[model samples]
Target: MKLQNSYLADFLSLLFPQLCPACGNDLVAHEKIICTDCLYNLPQTNFHLHADNIVARQFWGKINLETAYALYYFTKGGKVQNLMHHFKYNGMQQIGNLLGNIAGSQLNKNEKFAGVDYIIPVPLHKSRLKERGYNQSACFAHGLAEKLPAVVEENNLVRTKATQTQTHRSRFARFENMQEVFVVNNPERLKDKHVLLVDDIVTTGSTLEACAIPLLNIPGLKLSIATIAYAE
Candidate 1:
């Protein structure tokens, strides 16, 4: 039966081969979402290993963060971007889990990420959530939780308003647009906890700063940030 199942799977794969989103190559049996070569070649930032990384520096005076990190560096028309395009727009949600797991493994070894009590993804407004069907950050958070000693907390930090896209906005303009856009539904749950706020990408850092403001206001809350990619 096992041999027959393997043969059947191979036959099906030949007809509908699973291609790696990063490199457009066939995914071998053990690989999922992205191929091994592409995964290894990914431009890792290794920000978790340092204190004053670029992502962390972005929040220096604007907001307080214990640490910050991103799994990969995003360049225009790069493999990481290709993977992201598929992950966000192509309904390839599993890509989030795969990248998150890889990130969590690295973060688990870092002392700065120790004792994370809650892992919260920056929430999407209901309308956008309805449109996207799933929060990409939450998928990444869940995968991170699988390898960490933290609980994935959803809906606690909520996006109360849906702002326009930040695609071409200036840093200050982006920050202004995100102002008063998020609210903490149950502050008590995050109070006195070490919360790790996650997002899919960090570009201007305005959206994350907005999300961090409310979370940092919670009493005794130590906040940190993580993301799948960092764009310059």
Candidate 2:
């Protein structure tokens, strides 16, 4: 009966074949979001191995974070951008999950991220969350936790105010605008914990640093950051 069920499932799948999210190609037997070629060809940053990488330098003189890395290099009108479009606009939450899991596997090979106690995603405001149906960054964090095998905490950070989108803002403006936007959900619970802070992409990093400031102020708390891509 189980074999019959498997055959029936295959027949139904053939009736409505799956397509890859990255290239819109036919989905392979083991594929979910991306095809093997796109997976192999996507640009990777490999920023974790070096401590003083440019991506990490964005945080310098700011929060004094423990470790920072991004998995891919984002280019305008490029494949990474296309993937992000699907991730955000196409409701391809699984694509973010795939990126996060892939990046997490790379991070898993490094010992730097092993001691993470809790994963904290840069939170979207409640109103926006209601509209979007999901926080893309949180989806990535969930996938990371699965790959890293750690527990993730949601809504531990809240966006206190809605601000203008950072895309149109200057770096300094992004910093100033985002300063009062985030507040840690519970300071007491986070104290003395090595927290892994996550986001979908790091552009000016003013947003990440803005989010990090309030969290880092918690006594004995350590901050590390990860993102799917670094806009270079």
Candidate 3:
């Protein structure tokens, strides 16, 4: 029965091939959003394996962090960037889930992220969330939690106001624009808990810093960050 089902699936795939989100090529029966080739070629950062990685160092003087990790290295016109564009702008949110699960499985093997008690996605402003129909970071958080033991929490951190896009801003400008934009709710529940803050991408680290500021107020809270890609 299983073999017959497989053959049926392959026949259907041949009749109506699904396109790979990253490369715009025909997807095999096994491929979902991205093809296997693109998945294998993603430039991984592997920051979770090293405590003193570049990502962690970004927050050294800016904010205290337990550790920071990003799964892929993003470059202009690169495969990773292409994938991110589809995941964010093209409404291929499942790509976020698929990538998050893969990244989460890798992080699960590392001991640094083992103590995470909760996963908090960098919240989007209500207006943006309404327009986008989903919070991309929260989608990543949910997918990561599927592979890790931590619970996903989207409500604890809230975006107080909508800000302009940071794509063209300098690091200092981005930081200034995002300051005090996030606030924590129900701080009592997060006290002394090890939290993993997640985002779809990290560029200037300013957004993460803004989100982390409110979380830092929680007593005894240990913070770590995870992003799908790191733009260098």
Query: What is candidate 2's lDDT per residue for 65-140, written digit by digit as tens?
Result: 8899998888998888888888987788988788878988988877878778889998988888888889999999
Give the Å shift of residue 211 in candidate 3: 0.6
Candidate 3 weakest ten by summed lDDT? 21-30
Ranking by lDDT: 1, 3, 2
Put down candidate 1 lDDT per residue, 1-232, tens digits, no spaces. Answer: 9999989988888999999999899987878788989988999998988898999999888888889999999999999999999999999999999888999999999987977999999999999989999999999999999889999999899998989999999999999999999999899999899999999999999999999999989999999999999999
Q: Candidate 1 vs candidate 3: which has greater TM-score?
A: 1
TM of each candidate vs. truth? 0.98, 0.92, 0.94
lDDT of 3 by residue, 39-158 (tens): 888788878778898888889998889889999998898888888888888888898898889989988998868789999999999999999899999889988999999999999899
Runs in model 1 deviating more than 4 A are: none
**Backbone clashes under 3 angstroms, per model:** 0, 0, 0
Q: Which lDDT value does model 2 have at 140? A: 95
Give all candidates' CA lDDT scores. Answer: 0.93, 0.86, 0.90
